[model samples]
Target chain A: MIRSEQIEPCAAAEHSGAWARRHVLDIEDFSVPEIELVMQTTSAMKEILSRPLKKVPALRGKTVVTLFYEASTRTRGSFEMAAKHLSADVVNMTAQASSVTKGESLINTLNTIEAIGADIIIMRHPLSGAHYCAAPHVKANLVNAGDGWHAHPTQALLDLYTILNRKGRIAGLKVVIVGDVKHSRVAHSNIWCLTKMGANVVVCGPPTLLPEGLKTAQLLFPGIGVETNIEKAVKDADVVMELRLQKERMQSGLLPGLRDFIAGYQLDSKRLALTKPDSIVMHPGPVNEDVELAADVLHGGRSVVNDQVTNGVAVRMAILYLLAGSREQ
Target chain B: MPSKVVITSDEMRRSIARMAHEIVERNKSTENLLLVGMRTRGVPLAKRLAANIATFEKIPVTVGALDFTLYRDDLNQRQPSVKGTDIPGTIDGKAVVLVDDVLFTGRSARAAMDALIDLGRPEVIQLAVLVDRGHRELPIRADYVGKNIPSSKDEDVQVKLAETDGMDEVRVASQE
Candidate 1:
């Protein structure tokens, strides 16, 4: 439970530019209090979302532009709905329909959006650091929706919020993340957020799919555990987050075949029993049925994948509300 | 430097009991009565009032909590964050009684009214404060006041309830 009064909207407006950060570029840039603020604020937003008329005037007169240069369904749709729910005027822009299809540069299009009076820009691009590169060239508050394999911060926030709501706490929880750990921006962001929040994060995958930098995760967090054995990784865990396997990883030779990946790492009912009895299962979906997880386990009582999606709106609303307040100042 | 007790425990109880009876008398019938408290201190007071009313009228009364952070006009000066807003049922055609600890500038009551209107159109919205300290900055006044204490800007009125703060008392302390 969060008191909306804890956020000083008046204090924010008193100073012309009072917010600590102008943009939400990465989870790596956020401190513990900032993350907690987002999580706490999200709880309040979730309450508002549950109302019969699920809309708030928090972002009234504010404009949020979601610009996607990549193909997506859930993320784009959720961002649009979250912004609209907050009463912010939203403009959805995809690469195919926008000037980017005609070879317009990323920075140029972003600047044009700023010139068009977009108070904030939510961007998803193919190249990593797309948000980082575009931040300097625009005045609008830049939110990195999902930039290549770099970060999907709002997704991570929702995942954290979901876990917090279910578990009642994040500290000291054993969260075993299993799948293509190498290229998953979801995994990367989760690792940063979980470890920062004091959760014991264990990343498990084939040695090839495990990113080389993941080994150093323990350097930053002594409790961070990396395992190649799925059974060992999930044993006594409080949560098991299964990552989506990209077909591109197989084409790039990181995995042998879909059959081999399923044989080695598929989260079926049998594998779920290895974790704690009350352990919840999660997947950053567009789930590959029978690939990342068995269909039964995915739809089972222990699954919170749908809750993750439902929470996505609340989490994004918190981000937009916080950023929109700052951008107004 | 020392604080003075304005309303003792027994007196606080009697005041709330009286307010409950007054609420029932004015509304004519207990039907469709919803008590909504402003967050922090106001919540327990509203619950107390609801409990007192239920005891007297032998009827059910709905109690809810409203967080007016989004509706506040002074967000730039104070950072607010706490619990979520929970309304028990539809407020349409129901008489909503907004409750709080102390009424000062009347800004909080104003904000609560704004939030209540957004939820649904109520038959009538009324303000009830445990203590009313005169210095209203807005064109708003409380309909029900337990006690009206004339005080300067240099004094603060604080209410403590056993449910939230482990005691039941009201005190006026000097700001300095």
Candidate 2:
């Protein structure tokens, strides 16, 4: 996390066309409208769902394969649901049952799926940007569901979608992302979105994960700041995004224990009390309630978990359609 | 700045009926046929297609209406605000035919497909449209199309079903 405003926004489409492209591997790749477009598209799509029958025909004849090298109930299901609504066939491959145990490389599996005639592949891997390495030979579109700590673009899209959805405007809001920023794809993506939407971004985590450089990524999205204290972070925040703490971090000695992590960084009732009364609280989770956030705060009025899950379909629908439909390859 | 309607009532019914016949003919049988209608006007059109297909092939059509409001990519632009999806049924390993009243820019269609995956996997999915007013923002096309009307960027194409609008029609309303 080096602080520098020296970098330039990637050239036109590289910056803008992310609104319509191949894979969503990171947050920095998208622009405001691109993110907003997905939200708007989902809104119209939701309108269609309000009726008696819920189905759409834009993806007829399309086949979307969701390959999760990791385990995810929310995102995988969200993408699956989005595909089904549009009348597209879906194939899911998660690690709970996969050929990886049988000794196949990520690239090999992706290429094999492409050969089998999948029109789109939505992948979630533990390695960062593993989707990029698989991009070359994947004859169909490649959608990165989650790749290591790199990103879960669709997750961020949904988070942004949920925020914009509840509030109508993302600009000028104060957003604070608490917890493990070092390893959270959710935090990384939300930082980009909240800041890009003109909200002030503050990343609060213990020093090691917080790092010195994140304060700089803030400038890219702009209006962002850094904080070491949990109290300071959520104080003026219009949105508080809390992330899960991987127990692995404790074993790796990132910290002593879940209790230690909670004492230092968790959004317990005391910390939650600091946020604006109407500010929204969001988590991309199977939450470790006591570990990263207190139970009461999570179940409180500010929590938008259900909305985030529901909006996940709309956001992924936007990502899948945008990436899968932009096929000239 | 808002969208307005085009096309007439009788024309909408004819287009839907025509699309129903085309879908039935291409699939060779209506046995595994499931009609998934895009939301708003598409839902009524799908019901109409089910009725028309039942008339044509002399069999019942499984009709399911789909709403893409939550799944659409253009939520903020909508005046009334969009809501989350609540689709019914299990689409796993079935031949599904998605029906929409109109096809323009293809963004709405793309979102609908993403929304589909949550329910279950489908064996075969095909798109049937009453109108194809082209200016595709993304690479998408309809399989069974009733009309291929040329449209300008500023023009809005609307399809009204008899149930909602009390008549069936397709119209092209241009921005003044």
The best candidate by DockQ is 1
lDDT tens digits, residue span A1-329, model 1? 21232222222233323336779888987877778778767877887776667776667777899999888899988989999988889999989999987899999999899888899899998888989888988888899888878888998899999898889888899999999888889999999999998899999999998888754766777888999989889999999999999998888988999999998898899889999999999998999988988999989999999999999988998888777656333
Where in model 2 is the C-alpha error above 4 Å?
A1-19, A48-52, A95-97, A215-222, B1-176
Indicate the residue-level lDDT of B153 in model 1.
91
Q: Is the docking of candidate 1 incorrect, acceptable, medium or high quality?
A: acceptable
Estimate the TM-score of every prediction.
0.88, 0.64
Report fnat in order of the candidates: 0.27, 0.08
Model 2: lDDT to the true structure: 0.73
Weakest lDDT window of 10 consecutive positions for candidate 2 chain B: B76-85
Interface RMSD of each: 6.9, 14.6
* Predicted complex 2: DockQ: 0.06
Candidate 2 chain A worst ten-residue window by lDDT: A1-10
